[model samples]
Target: MTPDAAQAWLEKNFAPWVLALSPRVTGIGPGGAVLEIPVTDAVARVGGIVCGQALATLADTAMVLACAGELGEFVPVATTNLETRFLTAARGQAVRCEARVIRAGRALIFAEARLSSLPEDKPVAAASATFFRP
Candidate 1:
């Protein structure tokens, strides 16, 4: 899907809280998607570092977009499993998530995501997820 359509899909489909993160779809193509979320106070913890929950949410959302790109359209899919590993604290910088579909089966989809701090490009988190297409 095109970037504009991806952005519109996100805005229309995601929850208000998820949309509150202000995720922007920068790129999208078959099997891959890239999204950026600003590091604002809403997503920061007491230390001003981006929280794990927000990171995970971003990863999950990016992977969903990747799945949509792979399928060439947005379809409802449930996350069967999601794993996230935090590598560093994301402070004072926007976060970018790059997600790609690892495999797409008839009833399942496997994807992985890497999140990094912008400009510095320092790794912040890595995530893998499985989605059930019903």
Candidate 2:
């Protein structure tokens, strides 16, 4: 899918709270997508670090877009499993996630995502997810 279509899909399909993160689809190509979320107060914890939940959400959302790009269109899919690992704290910087489809079978899709703190480009988190196409 094109970047503009991906952005519109995100805005129309995601939940309100997920959209509140202000995720922007920077790029989308075959089997992969790039998304960015600003590190605003809404996503920060008491210590000013971006929370794990928000990062995980971004990862999952990015992966979904990656799947759409892989399929060449949007289709209903459900997350069967999602694993996230926090490598470092993201403080006061926007987060960027690069997600790609690792494998796509008839019924399942495997994907992975890496998130980095923008500007500095420090690795912040990684994620892998399984999605079931029903």
Candidate 3:
């Protein structure tokens, strides 16, 4: 899907709380998608580091876009499982999530996402997601 359509989808389909993260679809192409979540104080916990929940949302959201790219359009899919690994802390800027659809099949899609600090591109988190067509 085009970036504009992806952004519209992100705005229309997700919950209000999810929208609060201010997800922006930077790119959507052949096998994957790129999403950026601005690091706002709202997403931070006690410390300044962006929280894991925000990263998880980024992973899940990016995977959906990646799956859409693989399918050539958007469809209803729910995340069945998400395995997240926090590699480092992200602070002071947006976090970028790059998601690739590892496998897309009749019933399920498997995706992997890497979260990194924006501009610097320092790896911050990784996630593998399982999405079931529903």
* Candidate 3 Cα errors over 4 Å, as ranges: none
TM-score of model 3 relative to the true fold? 0.96
TM-score of 2: 0.97
List model 2 lDDT by residue over 1-134, tens digit each: 68999999999999999999999999999899999999999999988899999999999999999999999999878999999999989875799999999999999999999999988989999999999999
Model 2 has an lDDT value of 0.95
Cα lDDT tens digits, model 3, 73-101, are 88889999999999989876899999999
Task: Please give the TM-score that candidate 1 achieves against the real structure.
Answer: 0.97
At residue 72, candidate 3 shows an lDDT of: 89
Which wins on lDDT, candidate 2 or candidate 3?
2
Clashes of each: 0, 0, 0
* TM-score to native of every candidate shown: 0.97, 0.97, 0.96
Poorly placed runs, candidate 1 (over 4 Å): none
Candidate 1: the clashing residue pairs are none
Report the error of model 3 at residue 102, Å.
Answer: 0.3
